[model samples]
Target: MHASDTVDEQLELAADLPPWEKLASKARALKVMEEANKIIEDFPTWEYWVFFLLFMTEFFLAVYVSINLLK
Candidate 1:
């Protein structure tokens, strides 16, 4: 809530973390990306349906705005 409390918490956090380069290994990074790609490639049709609905909403919104501005 107060400034001093925020500063103290941040200092405590900074003291505990390792340097960025030492965090995750190159092999671990590759493994994570490979797993993510597999998940994306295997998506079901139902998920595509959701994406279609979201896109249709945006398309309709654009059409509505264009018509109103022309008026």
Candidate 2:
């Protein structure tokens, strides 16, 4: 093969390498973001307070009904 042909092949190989590296980096970053989002979603927050309030309300209602039944 000629010198120019070898240089062209080298350039093509270099060009291909960078795009693969960039795609891999992007995939890694996306995976990290997805994991972070899952962690955030799993965590209990103010929503837990709302659930606690509802549970308390139900417990009070049950107690009230039981007391009235006893009377």
What TM-scores do the predictions have?
0.38, 0.43
Model 2: lDDT to the true structure: 0.68
Candidate 1 lDDT (Cα, 0 to 1): 0.62
Residue by residue across 1-71, what tens digits does model 1's lDDT show?
Answer: 22223333444555555665324333345556667778878877787899999999999999999999999
Highest lDDT: which candidate?
Answer: 2
Q: Which stretches of candidate 1 lie over 4 Å from their true place?
A: 1-44
Write model 2 residue lDDT over 1-71, tens digit each, in one string: 22223333444445556777655655555566667778889988998999999999999999999999999
Clashing pairs in 2: none
For candidate 1, the 10 contiguous residues with the lowest summed lDDT are 1-10
How accurate locally, in lDDT, is each candidate?
0.62, 0.68
User: lDDT, candidate 1, residue 34?
Assistant: 66
